[model samples]
Structures are given as C-alpha cells and as structure tokens.
Target: METNEILRNQIFEIIKNQLKHNNPPETKITLDRLRAQGFNDSQARQMIGQCISVEIYQIMKTNEPYNNARYIENLQKLPKEPFE
Candidate 1:
C-alpha cells in the first residue's frame, strides 16, 4: 500500500485499540476531541474514519455488537482513502 494508505490504516488501528473494551462515542464528540487536540477539520474527519475502521475491526474480533450511530457518523467523515 501507499504511504497515505499505511498512515490511514495505522491511525485506524490506533483507534481500534483505543476503543477496545469501550463504548462508542458520538461522532461530534470524537471530532471535537480531535480538534481540541489541534487537528484541522480534514484531519479530524480522517481520524473519525480511522475510528470507524477500528470499531468495525473490534466488533469482528470480539464478536460483540458495536455502536451503529457512531460508526455511521464516522463513516460519513471518511474520505475516498489514499489521501492525496
């Protein structure tokens, strides 16, 4: 994969790991957190998508039901991938 894809995937994994054994948060809440941490809107969106990927992986790995609202919200923020 390309560097961008790698970065996106890496970010996704981080989110997945971070959310492991936890409840999904609101999309706006996640975005707000990212922005508070100094990420721009674009970056915030990317991070959200990463979080969604993480959530999905977590659900599959643990066979537990994940939050659908947050996942949908994050999915809305995801770009086409292969960031520029």
Candidate 2:
C-alpha cells in the first residue's frame, strides 16, 4: 500500500484499539502515547487529529446525543486544513 494509506490504516488501528479497551467515545488519545508506539511526532499529531475528526463525524451522523464539551474540544483540536 502507499505510504499515506499505510499511515491511515495505522491510525485507524490505534483508534480501534483505544476504543476496544472500553474507553469513553470522547476519550482523546495523547501524542505521547502514539509516539511511544513508534509514530514520529508529526504522524502522532496527525493521527490524534484524525481521531478527533472521526469522533465528531460519528456524533453528527448518528442518533447519538451531542456532547457539547467533546464537540468543542474536538473542533478546537482539529487541524486547520483537515483535508490537506
């Protein structure tokens, strides 16, 4: 797979593993954790930002009740240009 695709998959796996442990859906992963798992600083940051984006999307597209705090926090953490 391409490098970007591989990175995306790794981020997804990290998010899945975090969720699998029964962490609240709004729990945010820390950059240190991702870095300890072998991701470089930039990659770790990107992954965490992506995770926040996904969580926000899920809350919006589903019947789940909106969490004002989590929504605001995730939005604040989101990269300025998420699609870049």
Candidate 3:
C-alpha cells in the first residue's frame, strides 16, 4: 500500500480508539458535532484525524509530550482546518 494511505489508516486507528473508549470525551463530541453539521461519519473522523495529525506532527517536531489542550481545541474548531 502507498505510504499516505498507510499513515491515514494509522491515524484513523487512533481516532477509532478515542471514539471507542470515549477517553477525553471531546473526540466523540467533535464527531457528533461534525455529523450534525452534515458531515458523514467517515468525513467527521477524517476531520478529527486531521487534528490528530497536527498533534503528532508537533510532538515529533518538538519532542514535546502530547498536548491535550491543543488536541481538544483543534477538535472544537472542526471543519476549520486545524493548525491554523
């Protein structure tokens, strides 16, 4: 498989985990909010996945621990395109 597709699957897996466990709660909230705004399930998860990607990028770039605040903030700003 192509690398981009592989990465997307991995990111989606993380999103799936978040949604499954409801840890932090915001993940599902964001998903539901996006769905309410007319986004389909896959589309909403992809949008949430973008937030995950941004956080992953920052963590790798800065060697910082995961930033829950930024994650949640990005989630709340859904369909807005994360990371400014």
Best by lDDT: 3
Judged by whole-model lDDT over C-alpha atoms, candidate 2 comes out at 0.56
Across 1-84, the per-residue lDDT of candidate 3 in tens digits comes to 999999999999998899889987999999989999999999999899999999999999999999999999999998999983
What TM-score does each of the candidates earn?
0.41, 0.38, 0.95
What is the model-wide C-alpha lDDT for candidate 3?
A: 0.92
User: How do these models rank on TM-score, best leading?
Assistant: 3, 1, 2
User: Which order, best to worst by lDDT?
Assistant: 3, 1, 2
Error of 3 at 54 (Å): 0.3
Better of 1 and 2 by TM-score: 1
In order, candidate lDDTs are 0.62, 0.56, 0.92
**Candidate 2 at 16: error in angstroms?**
22
lDDT of 1 at 21: 37
RMSD of each: 11.1, 12.5, 0.9
| Candidate 1 local lDDT, 1-84, one digit each (tens) | 899789777766655554563444455566567677788977876657665666767788879888676565554554423221
lDDT for model 1 comes to 0.62
Q: For candidate 2, what is the TM-score?
A: 0.38
In terms of lDDT, the poorest run of 10 residues in model 3 is 75-84
